[model samples]
Target: MVLASGSPRRKELLNNIGLMFRVQTSEIDEHIDAHASPQDNVMKLALQKATAVANSCDDAIVIGADTVVVLEGQILGKPSDTKEAVEMLQSLQGRVHEVFTGIALVEVRAGNIYRTQERARCTRVWMKPLDRDRMEWYVGTGDPMDKAGAYGIQGIGSILVDQIEGCFFNVMGLSVSLIDEMFKNWGIQVGTKIRSQGV
Candidate 1:
């Protein structure tokens, strides 16, 4: 099996589930469409990553995923710089935002491709009201610079979040339950030690 992402968070998630897989990051345009719904955009990006990585192998099951933070119909990806990260965090404070994570599984056999599954999971997160000093101090940690909406719910940023509805793993960038559901659709029960092409 293969994972088409370079995120350590994603790697950790898979490791926690005891899945043996290789990392194969995909190179694709990740631009978000202003008019596309968060669900549609994430799904498209995930499929693109999966298909791109799958094309390089003769037989392998590849998993690709994309995550985004949506607020008031605007999509927020990973902040490009500290300034942008701070701005994102400032806007997200004291409000409810949606985090959407899309997952795609591609099965390749003898060079033939079988599009197994593509779906998106959403989680609603509520952030505690933060003053400028608090937001700036958090951003100084440099954690938000690499996260969507400029916050890492699994780390120090967790303090900024007041509550959440839906899958907590989704906020972490991958939803293990959703991935298990996809595997079930392919007749593979998770935790049964199912191996793929290699490791």
Candidate 2:
């Protein structure tokens, strides 16, 4: 198995679940299509990443994932700088936002593409009200710059969240339950696989 991303959060999630997978980061242009819906955009990017990596594998299941924060129909990606991070947090405070994560699975056999599957999950998150001081303080920690919506729910940014309405793991980057469901379609039981490995 292969994970087509370099995100430490995703790697850790898989590791914690006892899944043994190699990392093969894909270098694709992650350009969000303005015309596409948030779900479509994420799923498309995920499929692109998985397909790119699966092309080089002889026999492997490549998993790709993409996540984004959407507020009022606008997508908020990673902040480019600390200033932008502060701005993003300022805007998100005291408001409800939706996090969309797309997952794609690409199956390769004999050095050729055989099958592909993709799905998306959404989680509603509410951010706690924040003042400028708090926003700046959080930005100073340098954790928000690399996260969507300028926050990481599983990290220190957990304090910034007031509540959540869906899969908690989706906010972190990948949803293990969703991945397991997808895996079932291929007749691969993740739980059984883990048990077989004595994990």
- Give the winner by lDDT: 2
lDDT of 1 by residue, 3-90 (tens): 9999999999999998888999999999888888899999999989999999997878899999999999889999998888889988
Off by over 4 Å in 2: 191-199
RMSD (Cα, Å) of candidate 2? 2.0
**Using alpha carbons, what is the TM-score of model 1?**
0.95
lDDT of 2 by residue, 1-199 (tens): 8999999999999888878789999999999999999999999999999999998899888999999999999999899999889988988999999999999999888898889999999999999999999999999998887788999998789999999999999999999999999989988888576456431
Every candidate's lDDT: 0.90, 0.92
Cα lDDT of candidate 2 equals 0.92
Worst 10 residues of 1 by lDDT: 190-199
